[model samples]
Structure formats: structure tokens, C-alpha cells
Target: MTMFLTIAVIVLIFVVIFQIAKASEYVSVLKGEEVSRKQNNKINGFLMIVFLVLGLIGVWYCNKLYYGKTLLPHGSASVEGERVDSMLWVTLAVTGIVFVLTQIILFWFAYKYQETEKRKVFFFPHSNTLELIWTIIPAVTLTVLVIIGLRNWFLFTGEPPQNAAVVEVTGKQFGWIFRYPGKDGAFGKKYFRNIDPANNVLGLIWEDELSHDDIVTEQTLYLVKGRPVKLIIGSRDVIHDVGLSHFRLKMDAVPGIPTTMWFTPKYTTKEMKEITGNPNFVYEISCDQMCGNGHYSMKGVIEVVEQAEYDLYMAKQKPNYLDVFPDKDPAAAKADTTKTVAAKTADTAAKAAAKL
Candidate 1:
């Protein structure tokens, strides 16, 4: 209701303004002072110049304000980030130069060619030289830009090194799941039907021996600095983008299809914090696509540490449940169950005796 009322008020305001303009024109006709087309053109030309200067100033001030606030974060932290930044600057410079030149010429022509009684207009229907100049210039510029862009793209998407660290990232409705290949250096096979919401969210086939040693985490991703890391990304539900802003990396996480990205972190978390001068600074992985209502909350943290530190961190993580229980051996599974039951029984019995 409030929206409807606001829209109605705006419509009424426009109607009132239109009526006032018509009435003013009627009053001018009554005064017998004819409207002069040349005078109107001159006024419009002057206003165009004023608007052009003001617009340029406004753009400059806005840019200054944005940079002053430090709204844009620093450059990338990955080895390939410098090349990406260079390409971006090149594109921006080309576009910026064209934008400024076109705007200047546009407003200057408007002011110079304003209608006047004493000045006669000359019309040139066509100029082949002018046409060729505009076309060839843009064509050459675009070709050069495209070549640079394609080269960068190929470099960015090159195959990962053989010694690269392998990590799997999965996106869902409102969260991310990361899995690391444990001691086996192999990711186990996964099946959609085997997915258990509580126990095995990633649906690893417990029967496969390779699945036993995978380490899974919900919101934290760990990496080794100076080591090439290959990320295999997928989504369980809708499409999502795995965005690592600091690395200048983004790839779509599509359901039923896996995508890969590779990068090497040049800076560790501690070093980056000191460089940024923000004690709480940490690298983050965020979902760039607007997938659903809870999309805004889909975020994760990345910790880049030394290789030794990463080894220590991995050593403390518990293996998957299936690793502790071999499905092929019923006796061993039973023995484990018996031990748990016996421990619980003893605890209960002790509690009863204490009450007595």
C-alpha cells in the first residue's frame, strides 16, 4: 500500500508540472513575444557545455572519493595475479582514453554548431576517408586487445603442475565443503545415492579403500604457500561461483559437472595480514553467483601457511569413519561395536553404584 501511494504521488506531481508548463506557454502567447528557435538553440548549447564540464568534474570527484576510501582491495596474492592486473590496466586505459576523447568531441561539436541566423550551415553527405579511419582504428585496437586477452586466458588456465596439491571444493545451497586427499594422495570415488546428510555428506563409497583417508571440512580451506594447488570444484544444487578475490580467481561451480582451477599462493596468511596492515586480515572464498535466498551467507575462509605448518595441521585431523571400520571384515566391525557397548555399560554400572 505504501509503494502504491508513493507511485501515485509521483504521477500526480508530473501531471501538475505538465499543466504548469502548458499554462506558462499560454501566458507567453498572450504577451505576444514569439519564441525564438535560434535563442533556444543558443541556450541549449551553453547548457550542454556546462553539463559536460560538470559531468567530468563529478566523475573525477567520485573516483577520488572511491580511491580515498580504499574501497577496492589490493592486488592479487597468487603468482599469476600480476599478469591479470596488467591486462586489466591495459583494458581500462584503452577504454578510458576513448571515453574522454569521445565526450569532449561530442560536446564541443554541439556548442560550435549551434543554430544561428547569420551563419549558414554546410552539409557533407559522406566522407570515405573518415569512414575508413574510424573503422580501421577500432578494428586494429580490438584485435590487439583480443590477442592480449586470449594469451592471458590461456596462461591462466594452463594445466596444473604434477606436484600440485589437490583439493576438492563442493558448493551447495548455502555452504561450501572442502575435501583433501589424505595420505593416499587420491580422491575416492563418490556416488550421489550414497550421500548421507549426517555421516557422509560427500557420498564417498565406503567400500572403496581409497575413500577411507579423505579429510573433509565445512568452512575452512587450508593451503601451502609457494605450492601449486589444483581445485576441483562442483555444486550439488544450483550454480555457484567459487570466487577468491585475493587470487584473482573465479570459476563456476555447476551441478553434475566438475571444473578445475590452479594457482600458487605467493603470500601466507600471516604475511598478507602484515602487508595489508590489518591484523584481522584473512583470505576468503565467496560465492559470486546469486543462487538463492541464503546466497549472501555462503562464504568460507582460506588459510595459506608454510608446507611444514600445513603438514602439522593435516596430521591432527581425524580420518573418515569408514577408515576406522573396514566394511569387508565383519568380525573387526563387531569387535569395535562390542568395545563401545562395553565401555558404555561400565559407565552406567559405575553411576548406579555411586547412587547406592
Candidate 2:
């Protein structure tokens, strides 16, 4: 529906441009009223033929070289996507009806009295009935649409089903970190300095007491079909947005607080593959916020895998993946920082002393 609308708008733009060009040409060539009017009418028939051929050639070449026969990736699993699909179909139907009616009325008005000698314009002004009809119709239609949209919005935000699983996701300047509570099913405290690169603790580390059994999985998100999943989101360094195009869901993941979004997959992995023409489908999760330089690459993949596969993957992940690093003495850590600064200052002083 959106594609059709885009094409229609493009064609309309081109038509207006052609008309403007023809009007300009006619004005330039006009010498007398009779000659100018005849000249203007002739422009449409011949000009359309010439331009149509040129346009067809350009379109064919563009399609061959650039577009091919590709379908867009629609990867949303949220209710908002379904609402948009419904809105698209209704909008197309109404727009088509309006377009046909408007063109018919315009052409009929123009063709009914073309000749200046034979046609006499009639003026019938100030009809309250006509004004009332046009005003009332549009007001009622707009009101109805608004009401329906509000109703849908209410339902969309109502509540997630009882069995929905909650997953916490945090965003940084150029990466996404997701936390799935281990056996306890709750998130543990996290600190940045405790992160150990060698141990694959890819960022959810904390300095305070950390739970030994808190397993934090890092890779990609995997979910089961027909299940509701709630994502609690936030940012660590800066504000970021979590956007999933196919599901029609986007929410800001602001720092210091959590935001939430929910989705349920209507199709299983096998079904989505058949529908989308891609067997190994992964929803591209993107950051909509201009967080930093690496924002462009800050994307994560989500796969709606089979229940069996999900079970196996979960089983393989160790329960103690988020184990806290050994406790560091605060005094020792501060002493190290002070010692480093002192060493640099002493080296600078030695160089000055030698120069003196």
C-alpha cells in the first residue's frame, strides 16, 4: 500500500511538472488569443507521447541496474505493525475512491464548456446546504478515524499476557548488551571497571557485591514463537533508541531509567521463512539515537528459533557466567592511581633539574 502511494505521488509530481513546462512554452509562443489557446491544447497530446517514451527508457534502465526484483525486509513482531498494515489498506481504498471522483469532477467541469463563443459561465453563490454538507462530511470522517486510532492505541498498550518473559537490555555508545536473569530470574548489580576482557565478560560487571549465580548471556537474542516477550531497556553512557522495523516498535532507551516494549511473534521460524523468502531470518535491532561514532554499527540480531533449539542453547549457558570479580581494596586502587600520577610528575621534574 505504501509503495502504491509512493508511485502515485511520484506520477502526480511528474504530471504537474509536465503541465508547468507546457504552460511556460505556450506563454512564450503566444501571439494572439485564438492561436495561443489552440497551441496550448496541442501541447498535451504530443508532449505526453515524447516524454512518456523518455520516461519509460529511464525507468527500465534504473530497474535493471539498481532495483532488480527485491522485497523490503519487514521484521516487526509488535502490534503496531499490524495496525499500520490495517491503516495502509484502508488509506489506499479511500484514496483511490477520492482520486477517481476528483479527476472525474475536474475533467467533466472542463470539458462541459470548452468553446468561449458557445459557453456562458453561470454563477450560483452562497448555498448554506452545500457548505454544510462538505463541512460535516469531512469533520465526521476525521473524527471516526481518530476514534478508531485511539481505540487501537489503548489496546496496544493495555497489558502483556501472563506468560510473557521479561528481558533487560542496556545500550552504550556503539554496542548492545542484553541481560537474561539466570536461575533467580532477576537482574544483579553491575559495575563497569569489573569487566574482564580475557574472560568474555563483555560488559555487565559491577564493583559492589555481585551474585555468583547471575548468568549474563552475550551474543544475539533468541526467542520462541507465539510467546510474548517484554524488553526492559536503558542506556549506560548516553541516550539510545531501540528500533525494530518489521515489528513497528521503537522506544527510547534513556540513561538512568528503564523503558519497556513488548512483542509476540505470530509466525514460527518455519512460517516466517516461507512468508519472507528467507529461511534463516534475523530481525535487525537498531539504535535510532545518534549516540556516537560507532552508532552505525550498533545493531543486534534477533532470531525466532524453535523451542527445542532455544532450550538447548539455554541449557548450555553456564549458570555462573556473571560471577563477580575478586573484591579490590579501595585504598590499594586509589594508591595505584596516586602512584602513577606521582611517577609522571617526578620524571618531568628530573628533566627540568637536568636542564638547570
Candidate 3:
């Protein structure tokens, strides 16, 4: 009801203005002057064109102000987002000019031919030249735009550089994990036997294989800014999507196989750290594809740190933490129990064989 009332009030105001303008246009006629409004049609046409241009300009600027991304964010491993951001201003410029020109042409035609009973029509039949020119110009314009867009698209998703840094991204129902290959260029396979039930140890816990190569156990990823980072993403249990709104990078993290994207950082991690007044450059990573109930809270952070800091950080990670149990004496106490069970199983097998 409030919306209706507001709309009605706006209509009434516009009607009042229209009536006033009409009256002013013929004020001399009302005062018994012999002049007709048709004499001033050229002036009215110019005024209408001005109003049309102003209206379109206002709408264009409003759209730019309302819908836009922030200029700064931490590094992202996708380039398409940055390309779109760069092209947005150009899109606005072209759209604004077209909008203003269209409106001006419409209003000028309407006001220039305002109702005049004494005027005779000047009729010209179809002109193939004019028709062909109009059609060809618009076709060329659209083709140019399409070509430019496709070029950017190809540039963004093209094969990444050979030396791009690879980071493994794994997704779960309610959280994210980033695995970095520690010191070794390759990541060790994970086996399920190593999973500790007491601790909520997630992912394919590769018990026997965690020792050949080290995996950094930290939740957040730390990378030096200005370096090319490639993210190889996968999911363990169900389908999930990796989305970073600030960086404009969103991609699906699927199970069974890995999906990858690459990007180079424009800003240094140290610069962002100082600007945000924190040692970390926090980028919110959320799952775009709903895989479970806790999907809304599924989050991850990327920390852009200096190269030296990142090196020191990787060096401090405990490589054998997964295999190292705090209480190591339990195995010694349970050794005799394991031998007794094996002996009982052998005796039962021998008795069964004799009975047969």
C-alpha cells in the first residue's frame, strides 16, 4: 500500500508539471495573442532533447555507483574476474553514450512533430541505402563487442605458465583445507588407515604414506604476493565450489579429480598487511555449491605473506606430526596381547582341521 501511494503521488506530481508546462507553452494564446504553439516547436524539440540526455546520464551514473566491486583484495588464482572488472568501466561508457543518443533521438522526433493540423506531410517511400546503412552499422558494432569479449575470455582461461605455484585445495561439508607440499615438490599420498577417531581428523588419511613427503597442516594458505599461484582443487566426500567474492574467482571443487586455475597477484602481501593493519591478508573463501547442511558456514582464508616469512613458516611445520603419537609406550604394553590373540586363532584353526 505504501508503494502504491508513493507511485500515485509521483504520477500526480508529474501530471501537475505536464499541465503547467503545456499551459506555459501556450500562455500567449490564452492572453489573446495570435501566435500558435507550432511556431515554437523547434525550441520545444531542443528542450526535449536536453531532458532526454539528462535522464539517461542520470540513470547511467546511478548504475555505476550502485553496482561495483571494491578496488582492493588479496591475491586470487583466477584472471577472469580481474578482466571483467577492467572492462566494466568501458561497458559503462559505451552504454551511457548509446542510452543518451537513443533518448535524444526519440524525444526530438516526438516534439518536432507535435500535433499541427495545418502542416502537410512530406512522404518518402523506402530507401534501401538508409536501411542498409542502419542495419550494417549495428551489426558491425555488435560483432566488435563479441570479438573483444571472446578475446578476453580466451586470455583468461588459456593454459597457465609452466612455473605457476601449485596449491592443493580440498573441500568438505563445513570447512576447507589447503595442503602445501613442504620442501618436496610433490605431495605424499594420503591413506585412510591413519585417521584418528578421537580427533576429528578429516580427508583421506594416508597413514603409511605421510612420511615420504611432508604436507603442511595449517588451515590457511600463505603465499608471497606478485607470484603466479595455481590452485588445484578437489573434494573428498561430496561436491563443493570454491568462491572468493573479493577476488572475483569462483570455481567448482569436485571429487575424484582436480580442477585448476591460475593468477598473478598485482599487490604485494606485505603492502596489504600494512593497509589492513594485520599480519594477514584475509580473503573469504566460501562453497558456492551446496553439498550439505553446514554449507553456509564453510569458509577459508588466504594469507599473503612476505617470501622470507613464508619460507620460515614452511620450515617450522612438523613433517612427522601425524605419525608421532604423544604417548609412545602404549604399543609396547599391547605387544603381548597381540601375540596371544594370534596364538588362539592358530589353535582354533588346527582343532577345526583335525575335526574335519
Model 3: per-residue Cα lDDT at residue 98: 81
Residue clash pairs of candidate 2: 75-246, 76-246, 76-247, 77-247, 190-206, 191-205, 191-206
lDDT of 2 by residue, 104-197 (tens): 5555444444545665878997999999998998788778777877776565445668887777777876777776666666666765565565
Runs with alpha carbons beyond 4 Å of true place in candidate 3: 1-54, 60-69, 72-84, 113-115, 118-158, 189-202, 205-219, 236-240, 245-248, 273-281, 287-296, 319-356
Report the CA-based lDDT of candidate 3 relative to the real structure: 0.68
The model with the greater lDDT, 1 or 3, is 1
Best by lDDT: 1
Q: Kindly list the per-residue Cα lDDT of model 3 for residues 1-356, writing each as its tens digit.
A: 99999999999999999998788767856754445455565567777878887887787788688644444333233345677565655676777688767777789788877657777888999999999998998788778777877777565446667776777788876787777765567666664455443432433344535433455453577666666677888876799998866556667898777787666655554565665567855656788998888888888777766678778887766543344542433444488779999999999999999999
- Each candidate structure's TM-score, on Cα atoms with residue i matched to residue i, is 0.83, 0.63, 0.60
Q: How would the candidate models be sorted by lDDT, starting from the highest? A: 1, 2, 3
User: All candidates' lDDT scores?
Assistant: 0.87, 0.69, 0.68
Off by over 4 Å in 1: 1-34, 68-73, 322-356
Tell me how candidate 2 scores on lDDT. 0.69
Shift of residue 48 alpha carbon in model 3, Å: 7.4
Cα lDDT for residue 3, candidate 2: 100
On lDDT, the stronger of 2 and 3 is: 2
Error of 2 at 339 (Å): 39
Q: Candidate 1's C-alpha lDDT?
A: 0.87
**Which candidate, 2 or 3, has the higher TM-score?**
2
